[model samples]
Target: MDRHAPSTRCAVITPQLSKRAARAGSDRRSPEARLEEAVGLAAAIDLDVVFKGLVLLSEVKPATYLGSGKVEEIAGIVQAEEVGLVFVDAALSPVQQRNLEKAWSAKVVDRTALILEIFGSRARTKEGTLQVELAHLNYQRSRLVRSWTHLERQRGGFGFLGGPGETQIEADRRQIGERILRIERDLEQVKRTRALHRTSRKRVPYPVAALVGYTNAGKSTLFNRLTRAEVMAQDLLFATLDPTLRAVDLPHGTRVILSDTVGFISELPTQLVAAFRATLEEVIEADVILHVRDISHPDTEAQAADVRDVLTELGVDPEAGGRVVEVWNKIDLLPEDERDRMVNTAARADATDRPTLVSALTGEGADGLLDRIESLITAGRVMLTVTLPAEDGEGLGWLYRIGEVMEREIGEDGLMRASLRILPERVDLVKRRFGAAQVRTEV
Candidate 1:
């Protein structure tokens, strides 16, 4: 039978681990919560979740990952419920996945594959498409074509999740290898283009602040609230896959580039992390990173820990203080007493570790969020007093464009005295244009 098309009817199973799964003990949420997320993942791709369950594993079985009796139980459910697809909410080995398919007589997808499916459907940009395709190819390469011996029909080159350009994927191993190479090469150029864009933005003196958090934690909502751009913000997992950037003026005079990026989830696939590193360069280079959280969720703490893990894997230290600001979002869903408690907790903490509670949907506490972001960006700046000849318009223009001009006046002696708050990195340029003695920090 050909399983090239996407399956509409699906069953989601969350396997609670008693042992290691890459970073064991990393996922500490209740199994019920995990099952809900798995169902949501299926929903993200428009799959109807007809069945969902929790499988307690004392030790993961090598053949099926589930016990033989449990496997038999699900097999009966598959036939009764007419499930065309089974989404196992854990990483399954090639052999394990094949065995499960044989037992259930349904297309079986592991957690990684389900997440990839969601990403494949959500990708809206060329760069996002490249990253998703690269990740899909990388993942599919490991599931050798030899595993599909029972299928009499010819298979497509695409991974488990079938989307656009499905016919273009060749079944030959060599062709898949070639496609991977081509995608990687294209991604390199995309990375270079992104770097050039960052360089250009640096010239304008606008600091980049990226939004990151657990999937569906209201990041895109907050981003839209701040930037006034209508990027996709829905109550779905991985709703916005493409990274979007918009400029917003803070409560203060400074402006910043607010980037809305793909949200993080617990046990994010390694293939995706390696493939999408190019797109996450913005978060790595951002001057301030807003770690948004759905404070009203029952599993909020677990979700926060998951986001921090992904950040650490990306070489960002979430606890390094000032750079990563925790934005407690979706407080509009919380009770009044709980909201007040969170506000008090945030108020008691120091600046570096404090969180800014806000309801992105209601426009509550937006000004405070902007102020916090501006303060962190401004903290790295130095106040400089520069004196240049009034006749030299070019030099005067550079200072105004490169820094925030707080005060300016023309001296009686054909000289312009201006005090500005300039980023620390740009201080040398000011000293180079004008004499070192003419530049002083009055404030």
Candidate 2:
């Protein structure tokens, strides 16, 4: 938090447990990729990675997660490198974390804690900050160990994570519990406000299109290309924490409200997922969902599976037919031959199951992507024509507000005739309000 303070010397240790553990957990990513991801997460928070290693674990130890010899080896590295913090790239229990800190004489944080810390730093909007804070408190509530050991000397502590050890661990937990409830209430209000905003957008001509994907998958780049908005599209993990919305006009004059949301990662902390549900509901309410992927990455399939898991957890059926679309981004980094092959494959696939291959960086294939999005947005929607008195311009304006005004005519009889494209849910409302001269159905 202090800009003038020195950077924390850090070490990242990814424990590659047995294949049995991997199979049980559905973790198919290689240990090297996991180690690389852990390092990226460290760099996201500006931690100087003095040491990075992946340990092949025969089994997880309850005391320190690593074997005693490995723990001692890391202690030597920490002392020699002066590592102030060590990130264990796996979940650790309170006892394991404390023992590791004692062995290495450094602040020991697990993957979940490191992620919470990065989120704490990246959050800009008040809603995002609240969500991160709530997650931190929930995580810290379980860590009733050394951080709360200093009881005699009265001093300030982490806002909600620590409380001077005034009464005891239970009292600290009480404080965290109270903060959690308050944050939950505030997030509920945020959810309601978000729902109201969705309702308001439904009264407009634009449809909601939300971007969802794994972290650092070029989603923000694609978003910037489509909307021409600067939204901190970086290669770092969790670069953009808050949600951003911008209006994008499709090729056929149809406009859409595009949303850029926080990216999902493998093994995302459950506390974060629970706390950010309000923010993630954007994907659920989206008229169209774009599942962007860094198709060039070696672990692209695994990354995609992780994202779908999160989507399923959020109550969105990833395979439920039409709402979700796969966007294979970052083709600019691919070999020309592979790129051509990918394009051909996409071209050969069935329309319903086809995925868009694009380079969000170079704007390659973006137009076609837009066309696909527009088609999906207008798919199965209703079409109707209404006639109104030319003097009743208010009714015409109302139609323009809610529906896509495709064709408009002013007749010699002083009556205005207009045709519209609207979501199926609003078809009945349009019929009841307009008393349309003719009604048509796309389905």
User: Which tens-of-lDDT digit does each residue in 363-426 have in candidate 2?
Assistant: 9989999999999998877777777787777888888898898888989987887888877788
**Candidate-wise lDDT, in order:** 0.88, 0.87
TM-score of decoy 1 = 0.88
lDDT string for model 1 (279-392, tens) is: 789999999999999999999999999989888988999997889999999999989899889989999999789999999999998999999998999996899999988787
The candidate maximizing TM-score is: 2
Worst 10 residues of 2 by lDDT: 146-155
Q: List where candidate 1 sits over 4 angstroms from the true fold.
A: 1-7, 19-23, 150-171, 385-392, 406-419, 435-440
After superposition of all CA atoms, the RMSD between model 2 and the true structure is: 4.2
Q: Pull out the clashing pairs in model 2.
A: none
TM-score to true structure, per model: 0.88, 0.92
